[model samples]
Target chain A: MIEKKYRDLIDKLIQKSLMKKVSWNKSSRETEYYVHFKKGSFTVDNWVNDSSVYVDFTLRNANGIEIVSQTFEKESNPEEFNYLFKLYKAAEESYIKVDETISSIINELDEEDTVGKDEEDVLPF
Target chain B: MKRFRDPVFALIVYGIGLIIISFGYYFIPNDLKNIVNYISITGTFSSVYGILVAYAQIMSVRETAENTKLKIEKSNKRVMKILSVSDLSKAIKIIPEIQNYLSADKDESALMRLKDLKGILLNLKFIKDIEELTSDEKFVDALNELSIHSANLSKAMMGTKTGLNKSKIISDLDNIENQLNEFEGYLKYGNYD
Candidate 1:
């Protein structure tokens, strides 16, 4: 379930290995940064062509189960552009800091699933 | 524990102490009757023996009181359990909205996300404090990271960025939301297995 929501974001993380470039992808004229997970993804887009930036909150996997998927966009002011870079940096820093703890969570979740399965099979009812 | 604290148990213990003292009353005098200071010595000995029994009873009552205090503290551990994770869940659910608000060109809308984000962050801190108080080690880091991400994101929104850092913000929100979801799960089921 979790793997599905963040699939694209996770896929993009492959670029992290190619982090040799310290600057933005200026040539592409579009700078996008995002995080994906089980529930939904929030994307902030910087469009060089239009010289505009906005953020989109896309809810996923919440189809009939939960309608957490209303797409909301907020456009930014040019003066606020630099803050996006800072926010992204902060996000990255926070992620790296807790990376180990996150791994432990996966382990714990696996343990829970394993235990649940074991119990489910044995319950007489 | 209840039995130990009961009046019935106290009576029984007191009765036994009396019985033992009664034996001393007879035995000590019998062996010492012929001695010069026997009468005085026996009386003093029996008195001292009775005092010892009474002292023992007092000590037992004191110890019981201390145990009861400890029991109350044990019950206090559950106080933090009452700090519901539902609030935390609700707070977590707002991250995407906060992200959406961050890009708002209108100060009112953008400022609104800051306030909402602050409220959620406050809730997160509250939950974290409760977890910390209880020494709940499972999801503290996750909760803290969620708060940090939201805070940073909110701080970023505070500026007048004409463009959202599209690629990373979406994925960042996703990642943080997932972490919060994990925390919610842990709150619900992590105690098991």
Candidate 2:
């Protein structure tokens, strides 16, 4: 009986992964996520009839811009949930890395603008 | 009441009586020529008294007006100075790096310079706002250059954290200095006119 239950769990994990795929795009200063349905009808009626699971994610930049995205799949299982969680973490790390790189570039330019000036000379009038 | 009490009213009544007496003298027979001359002299004296009273009233009004004008000018100067000081305080808060970069001596010098500027602005003798300092063409040009410099500085500050390009910072400081120099020249020359 334990062997049968383990086989069932492995089958369910494979079924979930084959059912959904999450894809994302960055454009116009925003990021969007989409979940694709790999099986069954693509019509609205089919989507409405399907059992969907939702995943939530957040992205933040150094300049304090934050974006939250949510996507829904018709079916999800525990194994798929674990995989999605890992993907979400990786995305967040990439976003912060990009934000920090931009911030450093801007700071460098500011330091160059103040060279060779006597203390008496820096009033904005 | 005493005859000469209420000096203003007394003078008015005395002048009116003198006019009546002079008229009566004119109508009297030729025997009253000496009386007519004496009455005319009295009328002239009373009119001179009324003229003195009117002169005093005019002088009082002039003095009051002058005092009021001086007070208004002083109040205006005080209000303007307060506004300028408030603005300066805000500017300093927005740019706190100014305090970090200056040496102790330079900091004191900057403080004293600001104090002197405030004194001139508050001195009721100077009648213009600091913003008006840019009215001169040279000052305006310098101010525009300063704006560009500040923009550059902001961009540079936004760019790097470590190993910051000091040359860009120095250039921006130079721009700011040039603008301030122009402003000071105009101020020292009393260019408000």
Candidate 3:
């Protein structure tokens, strides 16, 4: 049996991992969640009929990461759906971390060049 | 305790003996029965020898066919890997050059570079889609890297043209460069086997 507590933890992690600009929606048969960052968007869905969850997301810069993840479980419960939503949120948060980490590294590279160019522009003949 | 049976081999030996005896009766005189018997024995041995030679030829043909198939598969994999890596390298070389020209505010040169980059990226995407035709992991990874880099470059250029925020454009360019470098590492070190 899958523990509800673990599922909840996963949900929290996904939520924290994503960018803050995320939205959620729910219907009788399905629920959808998404997050949009500077360059791309991440989305996940849970279907009531199959008791399954699917995730699709993209992270782009000059290089981009696109990922799709899906998992199915036998039992259906409101609690499980709630946990899945949390997981989706956590995944979005995680993606943001990865994006920020890459962005920061690149930013560091530009810092030196940018400062040098600024100084050159300010120099008097 | 029962007798051991070698049904097929036994049947084949018996059939050969019968054929030899019949040939001896038809071709030799009864007065020379001893000579005919010797001739029959020789004929039986010759028939067995012919059968063994035929079986060996069939096995060799099967082995040749299998080897040819393996070689063709390997060659196909090698060709696919080369094409994929070449596409990736071209994209990496072209995109940043175009971005730098744009950043330097050389509109005319940037436009020309953009055209070149776009054409190369389109070609890379096409190659990635067809990568499934060959089962070469190195080639697939290279093609994937090319496709990703192309998309990032496209986004960066479009951001620049559309007057997106300066910081955003710079960020996108940085991401593109990182992707290209990662791709280069894969190309240099990725195992083809």
Top candidate, metric lDDT: 3
Q: Name model 2 segments beyond 4 Å from true.
A: A1-125, B1-38, B97-142, B150-167, B170-193
lDDT of each: 0.45, 0.41, 0.48
Question: Residue B158 of model 3: what lDDT?
Answer: 61
**After TM-score superposition, what is the CA distance of residue A59 in candidate 2 from its true location, in Å?**
41
Question: Can you give the TM-score per candidate against the true fold?
Answer: 0.42, 0.31, 0.41
Docking class of 3: incorrect
In terms of TM-score, the best-performing candidate is 1
Off by over 4 Å in 1: A1-125, B1-71, B96-115, B122-159
What is the iRMSD in Å for candidate 1?
12.5
Residue B27, model 2: Cα distance from true site in angstroms: 24
Ranking by TM-score: 1, 3, 2
Task: Flag the better candidate by TM-score, 1 or 3.
Answer: 1
Evaluation by lDDT, superior candidate among 1 and 2: 1
CAPRI grade of model 2: incorrect
> Candidate 2 residues B147-191, lDDT tens each?
322322342344411222333434433554555444444444544
Off by over 4 Å in 3: A1-125, B1-33, B106-163
